[model samples]
Target chain A: MSSHAGSVQAGQIQRHKLVDRLYHWVMAVCILTLLATSLLPIIGWKFAWLAIHWVTGLVLTVAVLFHIVRALFFQKPMSMVVDGQDLQNLGSGGRPGKYNLAQKLYHLAIAVLILSGIASGLVMLRKIDTPWWRRDPYWFSDSSWGVIYSAHDFVAMSLVTMIIIHVYFALRPDEWHLTRSMFRGWITPKEYKDHFDPKRWNAEEEA
Target chain B: MIVKDIMAPFELYQPAQLKDAFSLLDSFGKDAWKMAGGYDSLDWFKDRIVRPQAVIDLTGIAEMKGIKETPDGVEIGALTTLSEIENNPIIKAKYRLLADAVSHVASPQIRNHGTIGGNASQNARCLYFRYGLPCYRAGGNTCFADTPEGINREHALFGADRCVAVTSSDGAPALTALDAKFVLQSSSGQRVIGAEEFFVGPNVDILHLTAAKPEEILTTIRLPSAWAGKNFYFEKVADRNVWDFPLVNVAAAISVQNGAIRESRIVVGGVSAVPHRLTQVEGIIQGKALEEGTATLAGQSSTRDARPLNYNGFKIPLMASLVTRAVRNATA
Candidate 1:
């Protein structure tokens, strides 16, 4: 049996090279680790997880900042944003994009969650005279970091929800290859043609 | 690393010429499948449902490319990407319905890669096939969709017998309604099948939906110039606004004379195994002023043949409503 059934032309597009794949997987692990650590405090797990959470949060904050800077400086920003063609597809009923409809939505959601988590974590730190982090010790007696803590929990919950959906879809058999595509870098030529460029084969045939 | 282990084994053949490609298809037959944009094909292959021995890559062939305006009609090479078609000025002005249909296929990236031929030849996006389950359509012993009750909503309203997968391709209905011809090439020779006859029914073979033989390649699509003056429209309803296939879609091309319907063609996709051409409904509207009563009657006639599935009974009324809306829009 041939694997190319239902695919368009033969040559595959190298979406993510080996270096990109390593970066993506490493980033996934770091994000997951951060989520787990942050969730402990919100769901009332033992406070020990708080120590681990803070450590991972610090690591994740640095990593995210690095990623943002790298993407801005090295990667093409146009690829991430919804383009004119994307709007056309949304209007018609076409396939979304490389990241696709769900992926794009999730990307934005996670970015917001990460930013909120870091911002709130920074504010909760005592001796930091940041504008939003300012807290009068007497106002909230039991919890000096009440507002910051609550904001952190809320963003954490939202991040968890988004991650759950993302993982669920990723693990689903129908979408298994889509998740795998990140790791493999090279999808089957068939997949590259259908999902990426129909004309790839067309020009080949003509030549 | 884990993903590479699961990758299926296959040989890729890139034929730099249409003649060479046709010869390959002739030799390989069903064992060799053609790859277009890889959008639909790759997804199906990944699911392990469709496995061909060799993929005949048409991308390298020069003869299979290009979109040009001939004196007779517009010649759209089968490999013309949806994005190209959407941006083509001649197509935009002459056959807006074709442009409209291509515009709604998947996403910008998908449009960039997906070809018109691939879209037209795409298989039914049935739940059973998509989920990797064996059903009657896939040559299994049982019809999972059929039960003690006998008929289901997803079953074909017109030509279904054993299987009831909907024709999920968006381009067919619009092109069919606009009166297009598909130019097919094979090692034996070349032939043209009207867009209407391109899709076969269960009556021919319950397992297959298209009339094209495995050895045959769809080369070019030819659309009549007469359709230029006709008003065209396509509408689809889905679960959400983005990334969902149509629950039901309607495409209409009509010519009105003196405030009455002169000639009209209406087709519905996502509701049946093939583009269900509403000839009876078209007949009803001919020479009549397309008013609310006429539109409602036309809509009622459209679904007279529908054989709704267990989960898709809503399609009957939904199809009726769509036809009504299409008629109203064409007239207005």
Candidate 2:
């Protein structure tokens, strides 16, 4: 039983507990669904996946908002944000994080896609006689809907490309378990250490 | 439960004293592995390449942590995080080049947690072996890297034989160029190994890279003060601008006397199993004027002895270009 359970240190901080894992997976499914639905219109599958897209988009929007609230107020946010140290690491040619280089880029790409999707959705809504928020006179007028629509289309294309890369990289056998980190919440201490601590790992043999 | 069914079931041993740590290590022998930040170790464990029965956690040991400045040089603790080293006022003021190298290690979260000892001792970033294939590094019969038709882009440019995995640490070349020394501690006593001899060739022992005994711990890294006045620069060419491993990197430290290269140490990273010191190139550039043609010739000379694998032929030119750039940057 001791061998099976693995030894746990007394004061070690649980980076990801059961609840965190559940929320992450739930968010992943919702975001992926939203990404697919949002992309269909630009790729000419809009009519075919419209109902599903609309449903998923609405649910994702609500879910993302909820997640943001939870992260900001209810739960501690994961420290994936780019910091001064990260910028330094980037310059050094070392990918130091649970997320790594690709993952950090993926996060930024996703953030841009989400923001663009929301803005575009609001603009397109005006066509259906529903206005979420009227564009301020200082920002843009009805005549600039073409510009907004085109910008949205560009962002949608970028989102598709990012998704393709994301899926392709994720499916590679070496990286498949990275997805499992979201599901399992707790990475094997080995994974945490290797993907994170080169110094510790290197010096350990001597210890 | 079956061994295959166990997720991350490994024992954790935290010895309070260095002697105690060595005793536990000696008892368990090869079955015991040390844990620091667990970065590279955890990944290997996940791949099932390193399944140690006992893990000796080094985090709890006080002797192996912190950074100290001595009149001779800087003595960096094994467990000192890259962030700590990068942001250390002494390191930044005295060893700007080293600080610059550590700064580029990874992301902020990783730098905050990863130690210098771990960075220097990290394993090869060979794509094939990392994916859990029975490559030569895993003591398999055949060498996957040298197959008749395969992707050998990331293979070694030097020390190529049955295996060609390149040394994948960024800090190594920088440290080597600065002439760093590593202090190792075991039950017997203390010993110092030059950073240059730390990495073992793939043909030697596929399992371990350094010559450190199992019971020993890398306790300190000493960088001499003589390396301070020289201008140092690290340049790497990679696939992307941000957060990507270098295809080839050059760490060059040079002392210029009136427009002439008085002395220089050129160390090339990401191209071989160890940070390759360019003695031939340094010899050529010694007392020579730093001109464009000379720089180009120096670059060519540096890469003259390169023994690249099938797919990594581009690295020869890429490394040369990086060397040229590093020379220009250091001289400037």
Candidate 3:
């Protein structure tokens, strides 16, 4: 598209890059699998959920760690933050930079949930008989195990509601442009202009 | 918010020269639309608001894309992007009000892509008109925005268009205050119209915000030397600090010497079909020492002629304070 323009530069702006999209989809799939494997057995549809859930949770943890590295180094990390402009723009039609306030809140919530689930699950590894670790359920006392299990269970349950909201927004017709942008890495110019403020987002050089 | 998935294929008329542009426009007439920077015309096309048979791309015409100091004053080509006008040292040093307003235009990308001509001649800001309402601006008789249930907090306080949509161009008020003139051209010859007269009332019923004929193109904007090197104040009070259209914006170029006001040009946008100049408010403060209360009084007097709708009464005070603030700034 850039090559086609003789004098006028084309206006299709690049939003998300390849790494961001890949990390997002990988984390999405892993989280869904983990949620299903953990929650499906409560309704009696049981089929070795522990192994699948633990493996998916570990994969999600790794993916999230990779995403953190990428977000910090490769992509624009500042877009995920809440700054002076966000607070100053509390009311009015002012658009947040790259990510809006709601999106930032969602990211913060998911980060907390994921970190808590992983930290607590790592402690509960002593209760499981894995190849690397022996089944030393006695290593931590019942009270300790109860604390770890409680934290893990609470976050795991909270994610069910969180993911529902995420999925609902991702599929909503009004939000289809945003979801499509995640895959294509670009939004229609109209959507980008109408929703995002280029002054804050700084998507283009002169804009 | 494209109502269509793909743009309707049209003949892309890339006119590299003025002669070719005129010929192509003359040939296509109403079916051809002049595209400057493609930010405004493309938006209309992408939104399916207009389906042109041919789009006369003006970016390739190199002669029509620069700012130069003419004998009288500065002459900016119509295709000059807002970024160019906003950053050009000449415009900043001379037309500072225009530069200030240009900087706050719809986001940065739009500033880069939207041209001065496109910004000035773009469509009205009526939400109903854009939503396919059969309003007068949409070439229909009904005024949906004036209805009780219609959202009209930003509708015009003047030019009672059955449409009530005000001119949304941010640069217009500054130009109107500066006494700029638009140089329009067709195949036959070129004509000049004052910035104040370039914008017409809603009685025209054209599906546009300006008085440019369908065949004619705005080629250049010529500013008078009167307002050059003058003290000016530009203020835009949008819902956001940036990236939003103005709820009400004011531009004032007041010549004050020895703490006494001599000449003042106060023009406001987002309040009317055209950038309405506040002659009454200008008169209130003209030749008067702008003491602490004088600017406030001028500001308070700004709402004298405002005929606001049900939901837009806030604009009266908003315009007043903004006018007052602009006067204060100019005085300061």
Candidate 4:
């Protein structure tokens, strides 16, 4: 957040700053575009979807790599990982933290999808023409290429499903404030109380 | 920490005295809820289960916040922090079973905020009810955990209605074993109910755990003197040490003379909506001279009648192990 992004008098906590918000929206657009381009051609719409799909996938891969670096050093990253306590809290109705169990689980899903997509997508790139190189269709054996393609296809399907579920929860009326916070950078006192346990989140407690 | 409200907006009342509190309760009627430490009420408010017109904050009544001794036994205020109960010298020395049970509740932070009365009065920890999923406890006719579709491992082994989910309070079994009585007060009058009878069992009310009326308030809990000097044991089986409700919790207090057992009171929590008292096991041990191997025999004797769901069949042996451990430790 910038210096003026949050103030003590507002009784609000800065959840996401301008940089994080920008990265989030850009990644969302790229993923949505990638999905549309990949799926539309299969459903029989005829356009140059391959070029667009691979480009967007590459962009997403780079963005994720940047995200990993930023999170490791500059961001609050530990909250995104599911710990031993979280697995038990699933059945026990434990209290919420800064990022909830659902958020941590979603992060796990995204990490799996994006990392798999990137690795397999990189392997498949040898089959296609790129700006840097010409297409070498026989770069790998038939069986190895088949395995890479299968993995890429499976991740694409899972990503679609995960995005659908994510959209459903992110748009819920009570959770609207969560989406708003991502856009606006700060949350109301009531929103903070609704979503995060202050003692655990260790955010602005006075709110 | 209370969840931010999702229900209809409510008026908050902080009445200074018991008289003012009762009048607030009477006025609000079914639209009123009495909140002490608010560990339970906050979840209710967030889930939109109890949309109150006015939430009567009972912590304001200074009278309902302490532990004291009487000629008969000890009285614990409804608003008394579980940390206070767990660490209080009087409770640690006299009511070891209750203290032990309180110490295992969730974590230190939760114990600091959760009250003894609030722990008892809350609803069952059914994921269906908590998430407003399709189930009878969620006000629908369907019993999710009763069917093969829902996960039943955490459900009840005894006293199960259509909803098989169990109560999650660790404080309950110890209170029941110690023969505690919950004191209830309303504008009409005051009444005391035994701890076992305080919670509404399966056949009685499937949705709620307590039988208290909407306007009634749980004022204090009274522990009798008879069990104060007895040997006590508390054992809980949970996945983690902190911030997890017990998979099975056992509390037992036995009177042993020399090597022979004279009387026994055993209660188990988290396996059912109501704390299940193992009277048959208690009966079996009353006459026997307890030894190292007696606990193993008693453990096998307990599962003679347990009816577990498909996934919760493992709880039968788990319950036995916990009971055996509790009984063995009680004698030791």
Candidate 5:
């Protein structure tokens, strides 16, 4: 990966690339939209929410697919994987490579929920009419449809809880730098030195 | 995603005589929807989930409209509203458990419109099935609530065939505890079944929740003298005080003789497709007094065979607690 000399200032570390940041924000918007449109109706607020909810679900599914491909092939996937060493660090308090144990676990958990949600949502799409095709409610039997709906609803509820915890941590004063890095695409040299071990995370190298 | 808010037009047949209703059902067969109070049937119609060719209105039948006092016990008309059953002076005095359980169903308005027959014959209340998903109960092969990641906080912990949906009626367990018998009539003849056998699980028949065939109509519910005026306890726990189905409801009747329990029948609802009769727990506390120690043991024994789903593990504990409370209240 070629580091853009013009974009990188002196004494700074690139935590996220421009494309990755765009993907993150786009995914965030889609998830928020999905949650709001799906949950608001259960609490007495009524509108044409089903259409918006399904559309946003499709958008999120596409974004997640892209992120999976990029993270697997173009990025350093090993850095995010939690191993026995990470568990040892819980007691030893050793600095994590790129992500702490909690961060890695949260990422893995969210990934499972999102993928399940997308898969279940795709099965449900057949039950509704779309611009491209007529509705086929019999694509799956009643029992199969029940399983699909249960998974989708369960994933949505879990995401609501996980997202709340994620936002709470992101807004914390101590984690402000990390949240800022998500938006600005870079972290100060001081933040890099203070948070990560240089040997584990070499900022000069490709992701 | 398709919001089916209105029902498709159908022929509505108001039959004043039972013979006319049976003939209509016989001709229409499965295409006929027998409606009592329309509390459960209306939802199915409004959602367009089950579109029938004919709707048979049973409200006009005069023979199935009153509670009659029999020499053995009492026979309640199947079409009696929940409010009518709960407010009946004879039922409140002799069979208070049934009265108490019926009163806890939905709200006053719903009880006013919901009939005992409809409540017993109501469909499973699983969100997936109610939302018109092709679930096991809906003639599909999969059981969503049994999955590792499925939302099953309000699902079954026992007697789950392919579907984990629980029995939604509060009156079912109460009637079961009271050893009630249901009188059903079809075109050919009339048949009687015990309350325990009135309900069918997914294992017995995946498509239907009750034993009543499409042509058969539940005419009367007979409460035998066996359980009348026995020490009774009834409790229902729900998400809302009114207008909500029970998360778990229990009904218990025990006869006490000289500070010792003579016999008891305990049934728990909303934990299985059928009202789960706690026979083992009943055996455990057969000759024992209704004390804390016996109640605790009975409670622990009630959930011994419970196989809870992922999100419904809490139901095991909740059911146990309710059983314990029911046992203690047998004497109170």
Candidate 6:
């Protein structure tokens, strides 16, 4: 049931822009494809997964770089910050602004994991033949390489866990509107009033 | 360039005598790995992390294989399995802290297969070091665990020079607390050193964890009667009860007279490259009554010099609490 009495109408508030939506979906697809290509081979599947894995890794890395630049230069960075008030609100179940504490934490965790994966993945690319360079395993000592591999492997597994939790939350019945906003780039005005604090998060400012 | 996870073929020598083992070591030089229990050696071989030309099996040396009661104390051979020391009646009676500490190592399976000497001489347990990462302990120029984002929750909080890997042996601190002496033998001669002095820190030598030379072998561990029958306390806090090394382990043998401590030997492991003896804490607690105030004070002052790494700052508090607990347990 809609709680708002007047002024704001339904389906008029923008939650995400078109470029942000495209970036989100593109990154999601790349992550899923990377996971499949990297993990399927580990589980005894027979296929040429290396080339696909590396190529998709490069794409994901580029997408992450693009997102970082876009968020820093074009977006209001403080909107996503989980400050002291956000943490206090998390305990009290107070109304969130643009993102809740849990959402911010998930985003931060995903960002860390992906950045670590990209760094280690880039180092690992030196070990395999690519269009740009020949395979050079001796760039680092065995032990140094071991650290890279361990970091890369750790990030991969952590992303799997984070994504599982993410997808599970996205598929919930009540949270479907938020998920739909990622695709349609907007939410109903009723959802804006229902889920967010207008004082903390101004829709006009976001627009 | 090297493909790991496959054991390369190497020559094996089972020397029945100490002299023969020394000869094999001399012949192989630095290319030989002294195999006592094959606990640490096997993993290195399996991973191709260490490829020795010859493996000098000290298991064949009969003289280095049992526990015997000496006139002043007890002498435990270097090749004695952890399980043997854990189950020995004499060790349990006289130096129960050693037995208790040995019991906390890895698991029953590892205890059965692992020897006390091997445990004492084991390498750094840092994942980077173990995986043959080019860390300072592995003859590299840098310590991988010293980085801002390094996975070093199990690293050292004290005496970390260029290497942050900790001393992982559970038996070392116990022996140090008991004021034991390590008997080392080589082709040239035999020498005895204090148990506390046996372990070398990263500052002294990052390449080797012990004072024993490449030619020498740890022949015996002498537990003197000084701290043997004292009020003993040993505790190991690990990630798991069954199969894990300690995050911080404490061993204390305190001599109390009229509820006041006459003397105490306290050693902490897993917080440094060697078993760190808290001489300052010992001094502070001497002649003081073993009470809550003294224990708490001892705990508070224990971490005065601890310099924890990026992910191991928790170890400072953990080590301090353990020392406090050990002092309190001694009162109990």
TM-score of each: 0.59, 0.59, 0.60, 0.60, 0.62, 0.62
Native contact fraction per model: 0.00, 0.00, 0.00, 0.00, 0.00, 0.00
In angstroms, the error of model 5 at B211 is 0.4
Candidate 3 lDDT, B111-185, residue by residue in tens: 998889888887776788766655557754356676657799988887563457888778999999999999999
User: RMSD, each candidate, Å?
Assistant: 28.9, 28.4, 29.0, 26.6, 20.0, 21.3
Model 1 CAPRI quality: incorrect
User: What is the C-alpha DockQ of each candidate?
Assistant: 0.00, 0.01, 0.00, 0.01, 0.01, 0.01
**Cα-lDDT of candidate 4:** 0.80
Residue pairs with backbone atoms closer than 3 Å in model 4 (clashes):
none
Q: Per-residue alpha-carbon lDDT of model 1 for B276-331, expressed as tens digits?
A: 89998999889988678878888888888666555678888888999998888763
CA lDDT of each candidate? 0.72, 0.71, 0.80, 0.80, 0.86, 0.86
The candidate 3 chain B region of ten consecutive residues with least summed lDDT is B200-209
Computed on C-alpha atoms, the DockQ of candidate 6 is 0.01
Per-residue alpha-carbon lDDT of model 2 for A143-200, expressed as tens digits? Answer: 4755776776687677768768877886887775566555443445556555665542
Which window of ten consecutive residues has the lowest lDDT sum in model 6 chain B? B140-149
TM-score of predicted structure 4: 0.60
- Write one digit per residue (lDDT tens) for candidate 5, span B1-332: 64577888999999999999999998998799999999888889889898999999999998998787899899999999999999999999899999999999998998998898888889889988898876767866466666656789999888775578989899999999999999999999999999878887765566677788777999999999888899999999899988999999999999998877889999999999989999999999999976899999989999998978778888888999999999998643
- Candidate 2's displacement at residue A169, Å, is 66
| Deviation from native of the Cα of residue B104 in model 2, angstroms | 1.5
Candidate 6 wrong stretches, greater than 4 Å:
A1-207, B1-4
